[model samples]
Each structure stands twice: as C-alpha cells, then as structure tokens.
Target: MECNKHNQPLSLYCPSHLMPSCDVCISTSHSKCNGITSLASVVEKTKIENSKESVEKDINYFLSILDQLVTSKSKNIKTGENHCIGVKKSINEIRKEINKHLDHLEEKLCQETDIIWNQEKSKATDFISEIEGKRENLKEMKEHLQTVTTNTSKLQSFLGVHKIEQQVHQCQRYIEDLENDERTKEVDIKMKQNDEIENIIGKLVSIESVGEVSVVKTEINLNKETSLRRKAQVKSQEQSNINNMTMNIETKIKINIDKTIRDMICLIDGRFIVVDWHGKVNLLSSDGKLQKQLPIPGDAYSVTQINEDTIAITYPKERAIKIFNMENETVMKVIKLGKLCNGLSFSNNSLAVGLRKEEIRIIDLEGNTLKSIQVQSESYLYNLVYCDKRVIFSDSRGKAVYCVDDSGKQIWQYKQDLMGPEGLCIDTYGNIIVVDFNSQRIMVISKDGQDSKVLISKEEGLVFPQCICFNHNESSGFICDYYGTYLAKFNLSFG
Candidate 1:
C-alpha cells in the first residue's frame, strides 16, 4: 500500500484514525495520535480477530439475502403475467357463451318462420281445391243437357237444361261465397324481428369496453426463503475495453488426429468440443488434453451446444442435423432437411441453420421450420453466430463477413483482403473474434464492423487457424488450427 500524501510505501498504522500511513504521514497526520502501531503487527493480530470461517459466514449471509430478493421479485413478475393470461381466457369464454346463445335463438326463429309460411300456403290451397270441384260439377250437368237436345225427346232436354241451370247457379253461389270470405284473399308473408332482441344487441354494441380489473397491492419480503434459487455467476470487477485488448498465447497442445479441424465451441465447465472435417468430434479438457472422442459418422460442418449435456451438429452430405447427448455419447434425435445444411446456432430452443443456397432456416427440434431468411450472398456461407435477432456469418469464397437482421436485411459487412474468414465468436464486450484460414491468423473486429485489428499473427505459431472460442469470463481462450493439428490455449488481457 502507498501513502496518499508523500507517495511513499506505507508500513506504519495510526490506531486513532484506523489508517495505514508512511513515514511522512506519521510525522504530519499522526503527530497528535497516540499508540501508532506497525502495520505488520496489526495484520498479525487481525489473523485471530477475523478468521476465514467467520468471513465466509458473513459473505454467505449477504448472498442469502440477495438470493431471496431476486427469487421473490421474479416470482411476482411471473405471477402477474399468469394472472393476465387467465383474465384474457375468461374473456374469451364469455364471448363464446354469448355466441352460443345467439346461435340457438337464430335457429328457433327460422323454425317459427317456416311454420307460419306453411300455414298460409295450406289455407290458399284449400280454397283453390273447393273452386275446382264446383266448376267440374256444373260442366258435367251442361254436357248431359246438350246430349238430350241432340239425341233424346224435348221433355228430356228441358229437364237436363233445368238441372244444368241449377248446378251453374250453385257454382256461382260458391264462387261468390269464396270471394266474400276474408281467408280467400292473396297470401302475403311478412317477417318481424323481436324488439327485445334488437334492443339487447344495440346495448351490447353501444358499450365501450368489457370490464376493468381490480389491482391488488403486493408486499415483497426479502427475508423470506424462496423455492426458486438464483445462480449468481458474478464476474471480476474489472471491465474491458474492446479497443484496447491483448491476446497472449500461454500453451500449445498438439492433437493426435490428422484431419482438418472445422469448428469448435467452449463448454460451461471450461472444456471444448471440436470437430474434424471427417465426422469426428473430440472432447478436450480445459488444458487441451483429449478426454473422449465422440463417434459421429458423416461430414460434420458446424456444431453448437444447446445445453451442457446436449449438442447439435450439421451434416452437409447427410442434409440433416443430429442432436447428441454428450453424457451418453448417443444420437438423441435427427432433424432432416431438404437442402444442404452447413452452419448451426441454437437460439430460443430452436436451430438457426445456414443452407448451401441463399437461405437460412430457423427450425424447431422436430424439423418444422419457423422462419427462413434469404441472403443475397453470391458465395457459400459456412460459420455463423446468432444473437440479438442478428445473424452474422462468413462466406469463404466471397472472403467477407456479413451482419444481417432476422429478415436478411444487411447491417454491415467486413472484408479482409484475401482473408478466408471461418468460424467466429462474440467476446464479452460484443466484439467479434474471427479466424482466417488462408491468412493463418486471428482478427478482432469491432461489434459495429467499422474497424478491425489483427490480434494474432501467423508468426505466433498459428497455421491455418480455423476456429476460436473464449471462456465465459474471457479470461482464457482456445484457437484451433486446420488439419486437426493442435489447440493453442491463450490468456486474454484487456487494457
């Protein structure tokens, strides 16, 4: 420790002010203080006063309080959202009930209308039948009178004519009676809507809104224990500037394989999953030692971790993506694709796959596509990373890196001269760490893609650098070279 006044090393302590001081401070600030002790003696006495277990207990107590607060607040948020969803469901149920009742009333009215129509038709039909019968009777009597006049005696003709006249008179009387009856008038059907139902419908339409919800006051108890625990992955207090950072190689571990290394990813526990071009995946320890080799058949182009135990890989030749269980070392599921699939990224429980064509498909685990973005790249895109609704990928043939939105609209692109950009990863400060296969180097581009700097050169023992990944804290990282050669472990520092 140093002195604030003289800029000299501090070795003495002022007990009155509880401050450490140098010689200059002792003569100036501690001149009036009594019993100023040496800092070394004070440290020795503190070893007994502040034990390691007691300090740990104090830290644990603070952590417990913070954990409870976070859990209760998160639970309350979820509870409030669920309550809103329940209220919306109830509203839909009410609308459904009203519709059901209206449908029943409509059907009943239709049946009543039909009954009235049938009754009117029956009355009109009966009148027509009675008129026809009377007319036929009169016609038959007249024909008998004509036959007596032509072939029988005068007395017979007279009687027949008299009977025909009586029959005609009766027919005329029946016609008159039909015309006099009110039921003989032309049938006219009319419809009348119920006034009560129309008024109810108008009332419903005039109302502005459904209803309002009652608010309940919530009280959060920070001391209470919560069932849900929060995982606090606290990082170092020092912040890093993307513009001023350094990459220093710490160790280089040679791999036993000979094929080309295509892609790699850093795991949660500081391990790595690297893939060879020939369908082989190796799980390496934090120190770059081979722990296990996962038996995977077919050409694996890219790989991404869905979780600690699950991983998804794309097979170009197979035109599919296979999910593997790292714990069991078995293929759990396979998602088939019609086009050739290359790059892979797991986001929001779905895979964002880059096809050999000009399209990128977002699909679920069951191979059902959720979205497809059509890029305008002329070359084939290989490695990619998806974050913040943005898809960043590299086109090896085009020698360019692209940043595009979810709908494939261009944001910005970085083109390194004759640089074969391969796999890329995002750093803690949103900078992009991309490797160049042809240049045999590594580059860190600003998150905006407006500026870039060559972080690692080929002279630093890098041969055909293919993929790069950093740990969670960006304290250390690994750079994999092509041809399955080796993994270079490096310590990362930011100014």
Candidate 2:
C-alpha cells in the first residue's frame, strides 16, 4: 500500500485524521499535527486485545454472566443453616421427651391418633407429586432434543438449539424456585433460654455505688487564679483586637510614568524598576521620581527583580527577556524565548517564565531551558510568581489563579470573579496577591489558595490597577494603574 498523494509507501499514520501517510506526506501535509505519533507505538497500544473498548466489553460480558448465576444460586441457597441445625436438635430433644412420656399405656390411649396419621400421609403425598413433576419435565426435554437433532435446514437447527437451551434454563429455574418456596422449606423447632428472666435476676444481684467528687475551696487562692486568667484573657483579647482593627493606611505615589506602566519591581536599595507598554524600562527613585529610562528591543510586558541590582523584563510579542543591571544601568543580556513570554520570576537560580500557551518554563542564567511545565489550561498565563517551590500564576482568560509544583503537578487552584487578573506577587506572609484590572481590586489569597479576600478595592481610589508587587517594607505593596499612570503605595493589613 502507498500514499496516493505522496506516491510512496505508507510508513506513518496521522492521528489527527486517522489516515495512513508516507514520510513525505507527514512532513508536508501534517507537519503541525501535535497528535501525530509513530505507527508502531499506536499499534502496540491499540491492538484488538489491548484496546480499551475490547477489554471493557469482555469484562462486562463476564460480569453479567456471573451476576445472573450468583443471583439465581442465592435465591436457591439457605442462609441460616447453623440456626436450623440448632432448632432441629431442640426439636429432637422435645420429641424424645414426648416419646418417653407417651411410652406409658395411659398416655398412648390419650393421644390424637387420627390427626398424627393424617399429617404424615399428607407429607408423603407431596413428595410423590414433586417426583412425578420432575419425571414429566425430563421426558419433555428428551423429546425436544430428539426433534432438534432431526431438523433439516441449518437455520432451523440453530433456532432449535436456542429453543432447547431456553427450555432447559427454564426447567432449571423452575426447580430452583420450587426449592426456595416457603412450602418446600424444611421445618425446624427450637426452645431458647428465657433472657428476660435472666436479665431480671442479674439486676437483683448488682448494686454499684459511684461516689460524687468534691473539692475543698480556698477563697483567696481561687480568686487569685481567676484574676490571673482574666488578665491573660484580656491581654489576648487586646492583641486579637489589634490584629482585627484596620490601620490608618497611607497611600503615596511611589512612581509615575508618562506611558502605560505594565509592571513594577522594588529593589532592596528602595529604588524601583518599572516597565512600560511602550517598551521603556525606567529606573525610579523611592518617591516616584523617574531617574533614568532604558530602551529595550520590544514591548516590555512584565518586569521582575532577579537580584539586588538586576531586573529582567519580558517582551511577549518579541519572545525575549532582557536582563538589565541597576548599578551600572546597562543592558546585560537578552535571552531569546521561542514562545511568547508573559511572566518572569526568579527562584532557585532559575527563571520561572510563563508562556502565552499556558505553560511555565524554567531557564537558567545561560538561557538553557531546564524544565517546561504545561499548565493544562485553555487560557493564557499573564502573570506568575515563584514561592515555596510553587509556581503560582494567573490566567486572565480563564479567570483563575493556579498553583503548580516544579513537576507541572497542580497543587491547588482558586477561581473567582476575577476580571483580567494580570499582575501576581506573594506577600511577606506568603499570601498570593493578584491585581484584577476590570474589577479594580487587589485580591489577597492564602498560600494554599483556599482563603481569599479583597485587600484593596475601587473604594480605595484604585482605578484600573494592572500590576502589583510586594515592597521591602514587609507590610506594604505597590499597585500600578493602567489608566492613571501612577503607582499606589498602601500599607497591608488583615482586617
């Protein structure tokens, strides 16, 4: 067999369309098919015996047969065999006593002889009737088998075999039904111990006395311990009240950019690096003053601090990460990413970068890709953070935040009404902070993604906050507004 289009022997199969193809066809026609696997691997996995449908079908057939047989046998079987044996022993003991008492001439004369003879005669008649019914069924089966053997046409013989099989099954079912009938069951009699009388005698003998416990009171010592407990509780209550009270927050403009600032990172020295939509990486002073601006190759989408003096900016459209040194204020290097790089984070001496196709890649300083984690999502990952050996990222289209370990295994995911979740960061308490641009709020979630609450909202004068970053001050964060062009600095509190 050969491929009609390629005019070569079919050596490959395209799983996308389930078509056999030649090597030339595979390279030319089905080059972009991700599901195109080797024909040998497909055959080895999907043979007739090893196929999923075949295995399921065989298992279902066997289970059906076993289920029917078990049901039929259970109907015919007796459950309380041991109980019946005990009952029979008791009945025989009573019979022996009855015989002993009736062995006297006077007792025999007093017995109802007619009634006893009638009962025995009725049981013998019923047994003879059952034997006659079985004999008749056997005779009918023999005649039917002989007629089936003499059938002429093949179709008639096949139908006759099926009919005879059904008849035999029917007969067997009739016999089982007779055996399980109440009238056919063996009778058993038993005399049980008088449990009521035993319980009454047991209650008469026991008289258990459990004494009441009491404590001698000392007024002064008791009062002292109570006062100390009250003081400790009041102190604990004061601390808890402090934790629950909202602080007098202060918001300041830490940085201002003329263009749309997409992301910001706080360096250890109190300076900040902000990347704008116009592909400008700006160095800002601690109090919102633009110190210097460096022009990069493409539109810078995200910026992350790699060290105390270096920051990396991601250009999604250009598929490159430009690393810049803050002390010398120069572009150190640019790593070329083959796919769209949306988010950049530093952890374990590697870059945790998010791609546009919902995947996270770990790359070293030398640009060598270490491992790639597919997020298994339909939405694009816009922002991510590396913390606690977990890559927590936000999917704007999916409207969710996902946490995955280094091996691409999912730890937990939190989904809420997040409209365009863009910037992601982890606070000092390890809580995930996300910026929802449409909702104009900052969402704070626990590390495990279980507890989530709004940290900042539109009521706090945040207008279209796009990016978020934790500050070095520990309890404060920087949020950049896309439309406002100014960063909002606010103190973080739990209440």
Candidate 3:
C-alpha cells in the first residue's frame, strides 16, 4: 500500500480528462496519465511557447516598425542632407550674385567718385588761383600802404624838423634880445658913471697918470660890443635872404595840367590843320588853338593842307576835288570825277583818289589823269592815304588793304580777317592804321608786312569805327565812329 501510494499507478484517469503533455514527455512515458505536474509543465511550456510566439511576433512587429522607422529616418536624413546641399548651393549662388552686384556697384561708385573728384579738383584749382590773385592784390596793397606810411613818416619828420628850426630861430632871437639888453644896460651904466668918474678921474689923472690908462681900456671894450651887434644884424639879414630864396623856388614849382592834342597835320608853312567831322577844315596853331576855318564848296571828306594858304579838299557828293586858296577863300581848281570819290591824298605833285570801283586814280593838280590801278575787289575801296611814296587804301567788302607805289605797282597787301576795313592812316614809321568796322578795332600793320598788331579792340569801347587819321609827326592819332559822337585818341610810339 505504501509503495502504491507513492507511485500512484492509475488506470483511473479518464480518457476525456487527459492532461496536457509535451511530445517529449509522451515519448518518455507512453502513458495516459493525469500527471498534473507534467500537464502543468506542458501547459506552462505551451503557455511559455505561446508567450514566446507572441513575444516573437511582437518583437517581429516591433522590429518591422523599427526597420520602417530606421528606413524613414535614413530617407529623412538623406533628404535633409540633399536639402542642406541644395540650400548651401543656393546660398553660395546668392552670395556670388551679391558679390557680383556689390562689385558692379563699387565700380559705378568709383567712376562717379572719380568724376566728382575731378570736378572738385577743378574747383579747388580755381579757388586756389583766385586766392593767389587776391593774395597778390593784398600784397600790392600792403606795399602801397607801406610806401604811403613811409612817405607820411618822412613828411612828419620834415615838418618836425622845420618846426624845431623855427623854435631854434625864435630862441636865438630871444637870446639876442637878452644879450642886447644886457649890453645896452652895461653901456648906460658905463656912460652914467663915466660922467661922474670923468670929473673924479680928471682930477685924479692930473694928480696921477694911471687913471688915464684905465679910461682908454674902457673905450676899447665899448667899440667891441658895437661890432658884435652889427655882425648879428648882418647874420639875420642873410638868413632872411635864404628864406626868401627858398620860398621863391617853392612857388616856381607849379603843377601843370596836361592837355592832349591829336590829329594834327603839319602844313608847309609850319602851321597845322585838322578836319572836323562837321565838314570844317580848321587851321590851327602849333598850340592846338583854332586859327581859322577854311571855306569850301562842299563837305570835305578829305583835306590836304598844302601850305598855310593853299588847301585841297575832296567833295564826294559834289563829285569834285578842289584846290582852294585860303587867303582869297576862292576855289583855284576843280577836278571832276564821274564816279563817287572817297579818299584823297597829295604826294609828289600828284593827287591820289580812291574810286568806288576799288581803283586808285592818280592825277596832277591841273586835272590830268596820270595813272590808274585796281587795288582790291571791285566796289570795296573806302579810303586812301599817301606814305613813303606809296598810296595806301582800305577795301571794305574785300576785307583787305593795299599799298601801291607812285608807278602803280603793288608793294604790299594785308588781308584782314575781320568783316571790313573802313579807314586807313599811315604812321611816320610807314605803319598802316586800319579801322575795322565789324570788329570795331584798330589794326597796325608795318610797311614790310612782317609785323601786325591789334592796337585797340574792345579796350577802346569803339562801335562802328569809321575813319582814322595819323598826326604828321606820328605822336598820336584819332579815330571816328559813325555812331559814336565822340572821337577816340591814341598815342603812337614807334621804334
């Protein structure tokens, strides 16, 4: 019973109540046994296996989720990396564009800055030049002030010295008066005492000889005082003479007013002549005082003072050139020119006339035509003057001037670049004075044609300069303008 109780053999297990068993246990004991431990073990094992299967399935599911998450994460990482690379590339491109734009902007700024710098530099240069000019002017003013100050100081010193000299002279006079008063008082005392003493001395000298010697010494002293007074008077008189001489010299040095005289032509008799624009020919003294007005048949365009009595004038509107005797006031001869004559000059017994056709016609005083020469383009001749055995004329339309010899040969020609050459005058040095109408200037041309100078342009403020006439000695000249009522005077200094 004890052995059966411990081992429990059992056919008592119902087939329907079979315990769960593993295949290993069934193989180990081929028995239908209700072995709760084995059943529990098998059941526990099945449960463990199911639990393991579930865990494995869960693990597989988790692993698949993990794999999907890892794959998604990897894709996300790759995408992020690609995105980063793209963003970096875009940023680099943007940086490059920005750099290029900045470079272009910098270049444009540099160019503009350079232009601004140049303008500023030019302004600065102009400012500097202006400052320099102002400084020079200031320096000149300072120098002038210094000179004036020096002169003022010198004048003040001279005045002070002069006043001191006057004071000294007054003091000397006072001293002389005092000395004279003392001498006179002493002389009076000597004289008064001498009367009293003479009585005493005469009685004493009759008694003693030494008293007479003292009387003689007193007389010698009186004579010396009288000589000293006379010398003082002579010195005062000499000083007065010197002062009077100085005053006379100062009075003689008087200021003179300079008077300008112009357009003076020397006649044969040492008188002078001038042609006024009012159509009057005035005979003048050498001092420029009007002497007389010569009578003429018409308004004189040109006047030649042949001598003090004989004068020739060209009257273009009257179509006659006339020689008149001033003393008789009569027309001596009249030369008729059919065309309009403008200018006239007398040289070498011949009259040179400038015709409207730009021709210079030479005729004698008796109206015999000697020669004719074309000077410039037709219809351009305006004025003619004789100089150095040549006839000089100006051509307005041709803008030129020409000089021809007495034999009708061209010597020189000046092509003026101005609009018109209207007036002609010849200086003593054989220089030509040309008045240009358009430019309103005076041109000086030498006879050799090698030297030309603009003597007066806008500086003279001339408008429509018409006629120019040179003085006989060529010291000065005169110019007339059609519109300008006043005359212009010019100084001529030729080398």
Candidate 1 on 1-495: residue-level lDDT in tens? Answer: 787778898899898887899999899777999999899998878876456767676678779888887998798899999999999998899889989998998899889889998998887888778768876786777677667678778888788778778878877787788677988777787777665555456435534345445465556555543323445696644333656878899888887766667689888878888887556788888877788888877667789998989999998778899999988888999899988777888778888999864788888888898888887554555788887778888876678888887777787888855378887887777678888778887888778777788788899888888888877575778888776678888776787
* Model 3 ranges with Cα > 4 A deviation: 1-293, 378-380
Candidate 1 structure, TM-score to reference: 0.50
> Across residues 1-495, which tens digit of lDDT does each residue of candidate 2 receive?
877876898777897777878899888888998777677777767767546676686677667766776875575455445556776687678678857874874465446454565676688678779869877987887888788868368888888878878878888887788776765656443334455444444333321211112222222221222111334433321112222323223765745575566667777777777876556778788777898776555678778778887888887767888887867877799999998777789888888888865579989887998888976544555578987678998877668888999888888888876777778788766777788877888877677677677766788787778877777476776777774267677776666
User: Candidate 3, residues 326-426: lDDT per residue as tens digits?
Assistant: 78889999889886675777778788887765477888889888888765443334467875578877766667777788777877777846568776777
| lDDT: worst 10-residue window of model 1 | 222-231
Using lDDT, rank the candidates from best to worst.
1, 2, 3
The candidate with the higher lDDT, 2 or 3, is 2
Worst 10 residues of 3 by lDDT: 246-255
Q: lDDT values of the candidates?
A: 0.79, 0.72, 0.59
Clashes of 2: 1
Better of 2 and 3 by TM-score: 2
For each candidate, give its TM-score against the true structure: 0.50, 0.50, 0.42
